[model samples]
Target: MINKKLIAPFYERLSLVLIGILALGFIIVQGKEILDPLMFGFLFAILLLPVSGFFEQKLRMPRSASSFLAIILLVAFVGGVLYR
Candidate 1:
């Protein structure tokens, strides 16, 4: 036999969790357009990190110089892809 006392709080907590999940989902859906580019830029920066580090360490370039060179390399690579 199940106890009546334990069931009430359990149901209450479960409902709260479900409501929280639904609310989070609603917020993400509402902000999709604004969030998409920010996420893309973040991933793009991640992709550039290794190439930037190589320029900074092996080539002994300054941080800003290396990063700018990395951006140039990225542009050139992208342009070549588009051309071909």
Candidate 2:
């Protein structure tokens, strides 16, 4: 036979998880436009992190200068590819 106490907690936790998922889905749907560029910017920053670190550590450039140089390098790379 199944234990009733064990079943109740399981259902309760499942319901809470389902509700949380629904809430997150609703928020994402509502914020699609606002979230889109922010997410891209976040991803772009992550991609640039390594290049920036290289300039900062190996070349000993300042943080701001390294970040700007990394951005320019990436833009030039992308532009070259698209222009070809």
Candidate 3:
């Protein structure tokens, strides 16, 4: 007998485990295709680190201000890339 009260939590946990396994399977299947974008994002983040440091340390700006300016610059650069 599947008791609703007792089995509900068990089913929920099983569902979550299944979902995690499926996600892992998908990643394994598509793993090779994922590295390029991951590396690109990593390098881009490394490049941004200096600009953030410049704003925060050299310019004595707040983190929020630095972040906003960085985002704006990134958007502009992306727009330029797309336009060209």
Task: Tell me the TM-score of each prediction against the true structure.
Answer: 0.81, 0.74, 0.50
Model 3: per-residue lDDT, tens digit, 1-48? Answer: 875654568789999999999999888778958877888878877878
Arranged by lDDT with the best first, the candidates are 2, 1, 3
Instruction: Please list the Cα RMSD from the true structure of every candidate, rounded to 1 decimal place.
Output: 5.2, 5.0, 9.0
Question: lDDT for model 1, on a 0 to 1 scale?
Answer: 0.92
Ranking by TM-score: 1, 2, 3
The best candidate in terms of TM-score: 1
Local distance difference test, per candidate? 0.92, 0.96, 0.85
Winner by lDDT? 2
Instruction: Specify the poorest-scoring 10-residue window by lDDT in model 2.
Output: 2-11
Write out the backbone clash pairs for model 1.
none
lDDT of each residue in 1-84, candidate 1, tens digit only: 976654558789999999999999999999999899999989879999999999999999999999999999999999999995
Candidate 2 lDDT tens digits, 1-84: 976654558789899999999999999999999999999999999999999999999999999999999999999999999995
The true-versus-predicted C-alpha distance at residue 55 of model 2, in Å, is 0.7
* Model 1 stretches astray by more than 4 angstroms: 1-8
TM-score of 1: 0.81
